[model samples]
Target: MNRRTFILGGLGTLGVLAGGGVLFTQRPEFGRLPRGERLARLEASPHYVNGKFQNLVPVQVMNDQNGENRFVAMAKFLFGDKSHLSPKQVMLSKKTDLQTLNPAEDVVVWLGHSSFFMQLGGYRILIDPVFSPYASPLFFINKAFPGSNVYTAEEMPKIDVLAISHDHWDHLDYPTIMALKPKVKQIVCPLGVGEYFESWGFAREKLHEEDWETEIKLADDLSVHVLPSQHFSGRFLTPNPTLWCGFAFVTPQRKVYYTGDGGYGEHFKAIGQKFGGFDMMLGENGQYNMAWHAIHMLPEETAQAAEDAGAKQLLPAHGGKFALSRHPWQEPYRELTKASRDKNYKLVTPEIGQLAYIDGQKNEQFGPWWENME
Candidate 1:
């Protein structure tokens, strides 16, 4: 072959090899795979069927005119000239340990984002426990904050229930579940999420899947009622193959609402009517935008959600840990605080690893510690 032709051929071969390497490294199989057929069948079952879209009854939220501008400015400030943003820096106080939690009382400790350690009536329940650093499909691509996870899987107490809101990677970590399986008693999940756990070696009998608006009694005076949420679900390309909803936990002492991951909807009022009133309502207050308003609620909508659920006080979650959207990391809190002040809603902004005790009549404030991080 001529010298020029040989050089061109060699360059082409190198380019092909480079492309192949990139594809192989980024493939989904390198991460967690979808559930198997047995699990898929269960997830696809009609018992967990969600009604038509009309049944959800979506609520309208007023747009923030300057939201986009603020988002761009904050993005530039935090991630200047970078294509991807790094995780925020966080400092954790070791005042209360998750391992030393009392299983007989009503208490909650924030692990990060939507993950929480909740103890009620001698039962320990964990909600959406994401211990991994990143919330992405590829672990190496995204990163979590350094020294953030206060309690590792090994440090968790004997868990009576592991409750999942959906199958999002940020909410469901495969490695964390495998490590926690030995100590977990039973997993209570929305419609299709149990399939993911069962494929990861969790026993079928240990998995309890509940449909929307269904109620199950876990123990004496401790019951879980699945409520409607305006959210979609999927771990793969198939959307809504499973279901997603919030949960209401009722105890003899007090009632608490965990608004899993949802946007604003009228179902909140129905939930309030069905369950009476709650001492505390944990609602989503982060990573929202006008582009996807139907799927995630803005701070104002979160306040409205609290009112609709008949909660005396509100605990804003789904923020303060991971930077999921374009808004400033602290925007959710700022907006929520303002909305609460204007609307006269009682809101609690808890710090990472802080505890909140709920007694029937009195309300208390925990941590605005996230303010220090700003």
Candidate 2:
């Protein structure tokens, strides 16, 4: 071979090796959990053996049409000179004394995005906690709020339960989980997600896997029911390696529904029928676009979802943390407020770290918090 040809071929081979190294090392080894005994117990379930409901599908790329789905143009329209858009601000709550938060009653605090802290029946549960600065694989490229995390890991109380709705990076953060492992007593998650915790050093015994429609009694008065969500999941290139579902927290004082992240579907009606009525429904209201309508619901659909779930009050989530969609940061709130006004549904828009008491008749209004920041 000529010297120049040989040099070019060698360079190509090196490039290939470099690309493979980045792909393998950057991605977490999610399936390396101790599989023998755990797989035995998991295989006993019919869903596991048949792969009836759990399967990973390849993601399809779409052709961009005009400005219809161009994220850059949409972002420019929402925030002039995208680079000039202000960073998100974190609202720190006044120090919460656990003694003051009565566990005999019901209380909720929204920590931006879909993360929430709830106290009921003497149990403290955190749902989909993402305390990391960025949700993207490349941390520096994606920015979070400038201040400290709204709530630090050290500040958290000894948690009774940590419930995960899915395996999306924004919903399940690796840094936060490692920090919280020592303090968390048990983790209740859907089918494939428990494997992630097992690989991350959480005791296998502490992880409980529940399929759709299964109920686990946490305490005499507190129970969690895994309900269907019209959604898919994946952290790597492959999608939906496991199942995705919402959670219903049934306490003696109230019924709270955490609609993790889902599109509008008939399942909401089924949940209403099974659980009767919910005191408050926390549903996703942001990170939506026309291209992925079937995967993420629009603002109007969120209000409709609240009604379908038979919720007396609605609290929109999945916004105010990261810029996951083309819409302006405040667009969801603006549209949802109008929808709530037209439909006569009570909407709760809490500031970051604001406490919301479920039993109280007077609900607090925090913002348009995302508005002024922009």
Candidate 3:
């Protein structure tokens, strides 16, 4: 089979059947995990309960809260409210070249969706980058909005650290990871997430799979803290076998929080208390639905989460690239802007590929670039 076809079927590590059964084939393309010593370690982890990882707090998936599918409710959430679901024209964005930027300058480039390229303390960091046209098991579904997929891996500089929150296809593209592996020096992710990277030919030594609240010191001035989040993980069928989380990027120069993808929870307030405060928070503000409200937060909740996290500035993420849910493509920015009213935090709304100066996180310099566009 072709590589795409292999990815669709031979989900060796994460491929799940429509039923609850998980497909654990020996197909090398599927990227196996937990072999030999790794399996022994996984069996001993306290978080790995009943053959899968359990969240600190139980989370409801796309199905009904009881784990049963109510077809009427599911159908409405998925298919209803098609109006203004996406823009008619390609979204315009600023052109950015990472190789041309000054390494000493701390800045961040939002490459659509949850993808971010950040330069801090002479280190280049990438988080949850998916530069593909479609985010799906098949070729046709979840096609990204026009023009949002312009930032390719070729445009990226040598990555000092690649941070992955989970292994979902939308956040972890097979082809994109393959393209980026050579340039990436270190990989940071939730525990068990590096198994996929190791299977994909990454050196074991370069992979740093961290548990919640654990810290990885990068340089004399920089460190990363893996923090807890309320989210589930699975590429295909084996649910929660791997962990999902957010992260706190700590440097002598700045403190940044990245909420990779998750619903609103008290953990936001707790994370803030632990970190003291964040200069900026990269928040998930899209791809939400009431049916699966326990996994993704609504726009107002996204605003509140930033406030709860004690972020001085809110960087809207997980939107403007793909319509993973039924909401209008621009709804996230619109609602987040409104919800932020009278709130303490400043909203940082940069277009895709626009630069977010680390120093500017505290300044109200960015405008609503999403306004008056398609």
Q: Which candidate is the best by TM-score?
A: 3
How high is the lDDT of residue 355 in model 3? 82
Runs with alpha carbons beyond 4 Å of true place in candidate 3:
1-29, 63-83, 361-364
Cα lDDT tens digits, model 1, 1-374, are 99999999999999999999778645532333335654455445554334212225544422434555555655544566433222356554444687776666688777778888888877888888877777765665335656566668988888888888877777877778878889999888876677677657678889877778788788888788877788776665555656677888888887889998878877888898888878888899887777567778999899888888888778888876676666776788878887888554467766777777655233355545656663
Steric clash pairs (candidate 1) = none
* Model 2: per-residue Cα lDDT over 145-263, one tens digit each: 55425777767888998999988878888888888888999888987788888778788778877888899787798799987787777776554556688999997778999998877
lDDT of 2 at 307: 87
Per-residue lDDT, model 1, residue 269, is 87
Candidates in order, TM-scores: namely 0.80, 0.84, 0.88
Candidates 1 and 3 compared: the better one by TM-score is: 3
Question: Clash number for model 1?
Answer: 0
Better of 1 and 2 by lDDT: 2
Best first by TM-score, ranked? 3, 2, 1
Model 3 RMSD, rounded to 1 decimal: 6.5
lDDT of each: 0.73, 0.75, 0.83
lDDT of 3 by residue, 154-272 (tens): 77899999999988878888789999978999989988888898888899999888778789887788898888877888876577878888989988878999998888899999998
Q: Roughly what TM-score does model 3 have, to 2 decimal places?
A: 0.88
Candidate 2: deviation at residue 67, Å?
Answer: 8.8
| Model 2 TM-score, all chains together | 0.84
